[model samples]
Target: MGVVSVSLLRSSVFWTVDDLQQAAGRPAFAVLTQNAGPLQLKDGVASRRGFEEDLSALHEFITHLPAEFSTPCMMFTSTLPREGSSTIVAAFAAALARAGSKVLVIDGNLHHPSMHEAFGINARVGLTHVLEQHATLQQAVQTVADLPSLHILSAGPVPPDPFALLLSSDLRGLLQSATDRYDYVLIDSPPAGRFPDAFYLASLSNVVFVIAKYGIVQRQPTARLLRKISTPDLLTSGFIVNGALGVSE
Candidate 1:
């Protein structure tokens, strides 16, 4: 077993990467509903019924991860836009933090940056700056006040060349650094069918969670999207049928 370090952050517990690796596997894909408006994390607590249910489900999923995914670094994307993938990814991070694990959520969807807004933080400096060499990793990460164990690297200023930045070598370095620092790193990527960026991000992930909104994403297209990404053979994959559990949209 790897070296495990555990610390109590106020009422919540925080664990080091070694601890998570030895304790259990990564979480499974979860299908959650999209809030009609926004997810408010006042004091780092999620209050909505749907949100709480989803968080609990995610916590349950963590116990059954495969051996290969014990130290999971994964990405979440959808077949189409507005499928509630970003929201699910955010909830997953919160769930991990609540479990007393150090979590890092990176906004890799440069096309639509929402992680910063979700956490109510300034997106002035993040992955973009770090990739461009304008800022260091320490400068780009924003620590959540309510969840001391959760850190966010928002998608900074919209670059004119989004793909170029994502494909840059800097991203690989940053990702490696994150792996060493955080117990789990969840990246929120853009829709797979709409942009190629998701493919690139998925390549770096240990597992990929594809979200398909019920009544929104058709079955045909979802199958096609899955087939399209199977070329390199994704490390591990799962589906989150949004609204499938009768959660409000």
Candidate 2:
């Protein structure tokens, strides 16, 4: 019943995490991917099948994440523009919230903010306001009626110096405060290899999830970028390939 099913057709079409684990002897990512159909993006949100697949993949990834962290702040990033990191973070955050986790999504990509656009909300105030002391987190946080547990911190008005703002001590304090209040803090940062802002956010987060768009992300540069940001304390949750197997680029 519900979304869970023992039947193969229902299981593959809806969800069958238990059956997947029993059948595949591996994680749910591969199984979900196999069952996923083509996806279309409308207003920055993935189609149903694609969204479900991404949610399952990310959920499985989080399930395996070490339980040592009491409050996990995960940053989703990519090596280049148009890598679908923002879309993934948005959908992933919503999925987490729907599953009863309190998730705070911080739009750290000040250069080209997309959370407001994706959620169709006016970005009158956001992270910049909080960092600049113009607004408190409670004031900056925007909530959607449908997703009660998910909150968004838009990039606010794009500042003249985004890098400077992101590196500010206030930003660090905000991250700490957010992690304390929320079950998971999902940060959508600028491209990893192209912008220093991503590295800064990644340093502050306990987990880093890299998105590599198929065909768009070259192997060598991504490798170099990963090595550059690699840290012992940071939990790099490995790469998630966007547009995997004939999906749009």
Candidate 3:
């Protein structure tokens, strides 16, 4: 299946909607036209200028979403780890919060949780604790000091079997509770190609975005992952191309 949309981030070389349309062989539904620089955060607040154009594009995309999806919950995953999916999630969530939307970012990457560190919060009491009934949702969710509208639920301690933990009923409950409270809920999951966790998370999200590092990520695996996760109920909003050198004709 063809991609429904495409977002580019931190490209070392420039790219335009025309360039991406030529590369994808179809018009993009929404494209982040600017070359986003590395995400900059000072005391947990994202720099507006660093992601302004990207944020504008994202806002435009969200604004055009179907009306039924009033409080959309989105997930970000990649073909492989360290493909900058986490950074993308963080930047986008921060942008939403800065724009006065109450946003919650869940560090669903149970095996490798970095959202806590990214937001300068304690990871000890988070999603795992809430899932296990050791902590309440209120307790596990931490508010970012600099960005009051932003909240985070870190993955907490790494579990013996991250996938098994994700299977618990509490995850759905947590998501339900989150959607009831936040304007947007963004989840960060492990690499979709290497783990089933991403698929599971995709099933629970309103929209899914696969992150692919430009030069490092191969097309076959990424395409395979996208095909596997796309479904009628879930809007597989296509993928983000990160750190690209340049687009070739």
Q: Identify the candidate with maximal lDDT.
A: 3
Predict model 3's lDDT versus the native.
0.74
**Candidate 1 structure quality by residue, lDDT tens digits, 1-249:** 122322222112212222221222322255455341343454332555666675566566655677666657788888878877777777778778888999999999888899987788889898888889988888889998888999999999988878877786478778888888888889999999999998888877777877766555555456556555544555666566565444332
In candidate 2, residue 145 scores what lDDT? 64
After superposing candidate 1, which stretches have Cα over 4 Å from the reference? 1-28, 33-40, 43-45, 66-68, 231-233, 245-249
Tens digits of lDDT, candidate 2, 1-249: 643444533433212333322332322232223222222234335445555665685786676767777568998887888877787877777778888999999999999998887776679899999999999999999986678888999999999999998776477789889988988899998998888998888888878777665544555566566666657778654566655554422
Query: Which regions of candidate 3 deviate over 4 angstroms?
Result: 1-40, 43-45, 48-50
Error of 3 at 21 (Å): 8.0
Rank order by TM-score, top first? 3, 2, 1
Separate clash counts for every candidate: 1, 0, 0
Candidates 1 and 3 compared by lDDT, better number: 3
1 or 2, greater by TM-score: 2
Residue 161 C-alpha lDDT in model 2: 90
Query: What are the Cα lDDT values of the candidates?
Result: 0.71, 0.72, 0.74
* Model 2: residues with Cα > 4 Å off, grouped in runs: 1-44, 246-249
Candidates 1 and 2 compared by lDDT, better number: 2
